[model samples]
Target: MPVPLIWLIAALALAGAEVLTGDLFLLMLSGGALAAAASSWLLALPVWVDGLVFLLVSVLLLVGVRPAIKRRMQSGKGLLDPAKALEGKSALVLDRVARHEGQVKLDGEIWTARPHVETDVYEAGDQVTVVHIDGATAVVAKIV
Candidate 1:
């Protein structure tokens, strides 16, 4: 069997493994295998030279390019959950809310609420801004 054919098979196997893993490391190794294949089949290089080409390309990709790929993949903020959607949104007070107790209608649904500032109170029909969410409750402040 040709040395290039062996490299080609190894490349294909590594590429398939890369698909399953989702990490770029295996893909870099597959790229190295492809370089070895090219060196053997295209350049007709000796076995030692082809092995060296593979090792160089694979190490370069792993050390030089992998971190940038991982960083780009992780740069974006993750999708917001429904509760996070209410952050800084205005809501209507459904019941009088004091230091530690209140109710408000947010996005057409009633949620347990509390004044963000202990000294502030929200009366029924008052508008409040949801500052944050604490488990099942909305921490709100009187809309200025």
Candidate 2:
């Protein structure tokens, strides 16, 4: 096979592996292979020169480009943990919830609860919204 055709095949293989791994590292390598193919076919470069071009492109993309691209793709795309998902969810106070301690029924489970604010309080049977979780406690505010 021609040198360029070999490079193209390597690029395709790397790209396919990247899809299965879901990591950008192989994708960057595939980019380098594509560059090598271009150098071989378009520039008609020697094998050694094409190899050098591939190395430079791959290293540059892996170090400089991949991180920024990953960050952009991940922005606002974090998966919520189950506990964090409880924020803003409604709950029923099982005991008078004071700043220090109490109990509430949240997501069909009993959980330690507390008022969101120091002066805030919730009597038993009160409806509340979980503001956030602090350690093992759910900080909550009155529903209305």
Best by lDDT: 2
Q: Number of backbone collisions per candidate, in order?
A: 0, 0
- Report the Cα lDDT for residue 4, model 2: 99
Per-candidate local distance difference test? 0.93, 0.94
Candidate 2 lDDT tens digits, 91-123: 999999997889999999999998988898899
Segments in model 1 whose C-alpha atoms lie over 4 Å from true places: 19-23, 44-46, 71-85, 95-103, 108-112, 117-123
TM-scores, all candidates, are: 0.63, 0.57
- Lowest lDDT 10-residue stretch of candidate 2: 74-83
Please report the TM-score between candidate 2 and the true structure: 0.57
Candidate 1, residues 1-144, lDDT tens digits: the string is 999999999999999999899999999999999999998999897899989999999999999999999999999888888788999999999999997788999999999998888899889999999999999999999777
Sum up the clashes in candidate 1: 0
- Return the top candidate by TM-score: 1
**Candidate 2: where is the Cα deviation over 4 Å?**
78-144
How displaced is residue 93 in candidate 1, in Å?
2.4
